[model samples]
Target: MEFLQILDSDIRPGGLIEWIPAAPGGLGAWHRDPRGTSHNHEQHLRSAHDYRRATRREGGREAWLGLAVEFDQQIDFPAVQGALLAWINRHEVLRTHVRLDGPDVARYTTDPGTVLLRRSRIGWYHDPRLLIEQIAGSFDRATTPMHWPAYRFATVARAGSFTLFFAADHSLVDGYSLVNAQYELRELYQAARERRPAALPPTGSYVDFSSSERTAADAADDRHPAVAVWREFLGGADRLPPFGILPAPPTGAGPPPAQHSHTTLLLDDDATRALTDRATALGGSLIGALLAVAALVYHRHGGCRFTTLMPRHTRHHVEFHGALGWFVALAPISVDVSDDPDFALALERTMVSLDRAREGASLPMLRLAELIGIPPEPKFVVSFMDTRGVPGAVEADAGAAVALRSHTYADDEVYVWFNRTPGGLRLHSRFPAGGDGPGEAGLAAFLNEFAHLLASIAAGG
Candidate 1:
């Protein structure tokens, strides 16, 4: 699936339909003082960070995640509504909201079967630009970590087909959950129309995940092993290294420009196989090959050790495999590389470093941060996902499914995500572009050369 900020934001439009949570019979869904549940460490940390940074927000930093897909015909509104509610009830995280007041944050959850939604037609929109702006603005306004039901859904209908859009605050869901939502919704939609139970398995609740994770983290002290990994990684530095993909910013300049992303395919299916085999020969997996190349690129820029932030999914519970929640843990990964070594040798080192890194990923970064006495923020992130064999992956191959993110303000940090699918490996990067980085043509040239080098490796060079 092609993940875009606003799915096909440049395309034309016809009409718009918005779906938002409503009080059943206008009696308030979150009434009767919902029961408080344990908010995960990530959620509590996110709330505290937002509270600290709330005063400095500029141009409304919209930090929502979204997904948009199309169906051949107009939506069966009633059937879709039933399916949506069923899907929401299936994932308890969607039914929960954060209470950001008090000294510490808490989560209050509404029970299933008590929630309702309303469909409102906002008239026709022949202009695509205005339509996109309206949708994005709604998402920015509706989605905030501190609010209840921080999400929005809409339908953009055309002559014979229509697009379904769904967005939520990033705290409530991760990239994997956001992509899988469309698949689950479609399954429920079909069953709702057929008036039969969906042929899907039950999902575990994120509530339980939060409770268990928090209990374990609270018991961890500064002496914890994970805490030591983080302390060693950031002992004295205020923050991690900024991705040196672009020229350094002038010392006197203000904050760097807002982040921009570049997406490109790195290798094709055949090339991926060849490269995978090559990587296996060098180490034990493909990540070693990927990390080796990236470390070398930084090495060329005089970066001795490849250090960056990485995300590790906490999906150990098989039951939560299909559930939606922010079941992600962040960890720091660093590997040593040498200039004299061949690429194969570098991969060997990377493979060993990766195993050590895996063993170090015990607690969430925020919990580790609390142990290390630091703040949690983004800087020099490198993420990779192997999406070759997931359910509904075939549809993504055709590019119907996509994960979306809202506009974000940034300083000097850079983030790159690598996705491995049957089609190939794709790279998507977001970085400070104007104040410190290369211009339009310069960035394109850099990316083209980067892709070419990776392609050569894939070709067995």
Candidate 2:
């Protein structure tokens, strides 16, 4: 409760909120409330994915979320390290350990003193690209226990510049949390440099969030309104329609291996602005418009209706606004473009479905899967993250600098990510390289067509 009081002061008018450790046996003993806290719905889904990957022939790749920030001038290495440590001490999620041995595998925020800082330095480098790749490579190889600390931090230094990289498990942080962590790191570093206390407020632990989610899920009846909505959306289908243009082979001719490849589509400033304006005029989000375009593409390719997973941020709680951890979940959105011949009509239908999906956004995919008895694996995924006003990309101070980037390890059949940038928008589509789904060439062509469709829709054609 005292910790809650500290968090309450964080948003007070004027000045930064300074954390004061509670009296002995107060905040320190909070973790002892219950051993092995229950796993939240998101954790269950993530763990399932992890398990499947582990069982594969090559095993699952490490799910690493990476961030890189470049500085215009030299940085104080020790100060940055201190800032990272300070951040770990302030946020419980950073200190939490994943417990995998017991009957119930849960996450717990343990003592701050016991939390260790994993830091390494990459010696001098002339090329920023090399430095970035080296940092990313290091992250790609790094691994952590599902029940252990979930993050690592490193810095690459040159004569007059430096880049900071933080890599953590996908279960540890989501896209939003990754950006939030960078912002907090910047502030904490500045506070450390000035020898002034950081103004960061107390944050709720991921454990607290898990407990709350468990309670809410239990209290809700099985026949809740959301359950019915999910039932209708699923419509007794066991598996989503395949996304590949080519029919999959019945059996493997050789080894059951998998590969992944991706392509990016960039929209110029004018096109991006027009697309945003058109979406606004249609009273929908950029995501809705994009979904409409995707549906149309699939419809034209001979599939009239199919289900796609859409990522939704689940940090609706006030305490979680800036909390670090994975707070993202996927919801299935069924697209039926059969009835609507006109693109405009199709867009309207897509918007309406999207609106309804948002109403039940809080419902977890794992729960929906159970209730609807649909296949657990997602065939196609669509995600959108708006980074219009984040602090990492821009130069915060004269000599100080920051940048953030993220990568996923899961090799889904098809995954499309949309990121909003200062220049315009960047669409990255990834799919298995040689799997039954569309091959690399087919995916590239699909992306090209999708872009053209998006442009035409934006032009109100």
Looking at candidate 2, the ten consecutive residues that score lowest on lDDT are 1-10
Leading candidate by TM-score: 1
Residue 175 lDDT in model 2?
74
lDDT for 140 in candidate 1 is 81
Most accurate candidate by lDDT: 1
Reference-based lDDT, residue 69, model 2: 47
Per model, state how many residue pairs clash.
Answer: 0, 4
Model 2 over residues 244-362: C-alpha lDDT tens digits? Answer: 53335436445334434443435755888888788878776677788888778777766677467788887787788778776766666776866545666666778877866775556
Total colliding residue pairs, candidate 1? 0
